[model samples]
Target: MPAPAHRLGLGLAAIARPAYITSGRAGELGDDRDVATLRDRSRALLDAAYAAGVRYLDVARSYGRAEEFLAGWLADRPGVTGGEDPVEIGSKWGYRYVGGWRTDADTHEVKDHSLDAFTEQYALSRELLGDHLGTYHVHSATLDTGVLDDGRVHRAMAHLRDRGIRVGISTSGPAQADAVRRALDVRVDGEPLFTSFQSTWNPLEPSVGPALAEAADAGARVIVKEVFANGRLAPGGEDGTEGARAAAALAARTGVPLDRIAVAAALANPWAWRVLLGPVGTDQLASNLAGAELTLPADAAEELTALAEPAEHYWATRSARPWS
Candidate 1:
């Protein structure tokens, strides 16, 4: 098995925008969320992640200048952006950032999975990241969005695949299993259109495990996101829920932080190719990286497994979280 550090990736979601749905943002980022401040913070995080041996970087169009921040950081690093061992970069489309850099924006992003949306976002992503962009995913692709069933979108993504860029889908909500299974059936010119999959999988909500396993079996790269459940499992995070309480107890007994335990749980899944960590600061990044060193015992892992909540309840709690 590859070292956990090698399998860990940094997600630029929390730092790319002024506000996100993740908990503990107020304490982590405070009120200094201006564009330049966040840009600098993003660069600092990229520096720390690269220095710590984290190579895979996740970004998206709806992540409010995340792609732009990554582009700038890559430009500063000559050999890091290209060459044989360049960092693996994955980005997503299908949603437009509408927050206008405002933390109080009524609508932060608007989703449109149409061919037109793909065309526009693909052009923008290419314009910003250029060839550094490795895999492109459909942001929050659900069955109801018809993204998996859209033949035109598949053909467009197939064109990118021909150009050597891998295409995939990132799933969300309670129906992640349904979406992942459906995406597995998507084909273009008799070939699999998507070779990568990203989905939320933490100790608290692991309902998509079976589908992700099937995706990995199909030779798809399975990436786990929201491993900390949007900061609810992180230190100083919300611990009111039953799942969170159980995780806290386990963490207490094991003398490990909840964030590290969360990361270990996600990494324990053999099917996970890259487990993403969303950290707003270097301290959090360091703590999360240490999780890669942990060897979670089987019994302890099972104890955490008992923390699983119904997919509906998990997502409902997530949706109700205030965007700070």
Candidate 2:
């Protein structure tokens, strides 16, 4: 069955900033990395996405003004501004963008999952996004960060949850399953703290699937991100990888682009409440949305599962992808 329109979201990770880790960004975005240029580009993509039936938008403090760009788009768009056509906005904190908008910056973002970091970043996000922000997540929560164990952070997130904002965690690294399991156990005021989970889940790294399914069973909203494996499953992506090659072969046989196939794979996950699309432009967004309409053959779906790589190896390759 095809994924519903409401089951898809637009993530502003690549367009809100000039340089991102997604492959083909250099070709898609070109040399125009200025703030104004990117802001305009972000708004254009947001407009296109909303028109294409995407009602959920994801951003982050570490995404180099992604929250600000989204705020601007919300303010400028008439129907969206007045809630005539409301869209759910989800943003992450705990990471500060230190790239200074430069592609060659030694460090792009710095993670600090401390309560102090949450207090400061949450205020900034609310100042910009205001009532439009429906959900807030810990940018990249892992066991090492101790965020799951931090009582202060849990209290703060719980306070937000009480105020009608959905609290969640966006997991990263190879131990995503571990993080999701840990977060599921977190509670505040004797109640579950996190009700939303955004994590990377693609054919190359399907390690988090079982844990995410458990989260869904626990009544948590499960959002799947990085479905393209940081663009490795997209058109002109790194086809040398085994998973990418399998996806490409399937695409060729089915007459569907590799990107769409990737999207279809993510949408096929019964536990996935929403699949995020990180397209650089309108054309890419259209191509990705088409995947929602695609229902892969059962044999093809089984073949894709065999392409799963070791979680550690998959993450290592993703880490080496330069921010271009």
Using lDDT as the measure, the top candidate is 1
What clash pairs does model 2 have?
Answer: none
Instruction: Score every model by TM-score.
Output: 0.98, 0.97
Residue 127 lDDT in candidate 1: 99
User: Local distance difference test, per candidate?
Assistant: 0.92, 0.90
Pairs clashing within candidate 1: none
- Residues 151-207 of candidate 2: C-alpha lDDT, one tens digit per residue: 989998999999999999999999999999999999888999998999999998999
lDDT of 2 at 105: 91
Candidate 1: segments with Cα more than 4 A from true spot: none
Clashes of 2: 0
* Global Cα lDDT for candidate 2: 0.90
After the best TM-score superposition of candidate 2, give how far the Cα of residue 184 lies from its true spot, in angstroms. 0.9
Per-residue lDDT of candidate 1, residues 134-250 (tens digit): 999999999998889989899999999999999999999999999999999988889999899999999889999999999999999999999999888988886598888778888
Residue 204, model 2, lDDT = 88
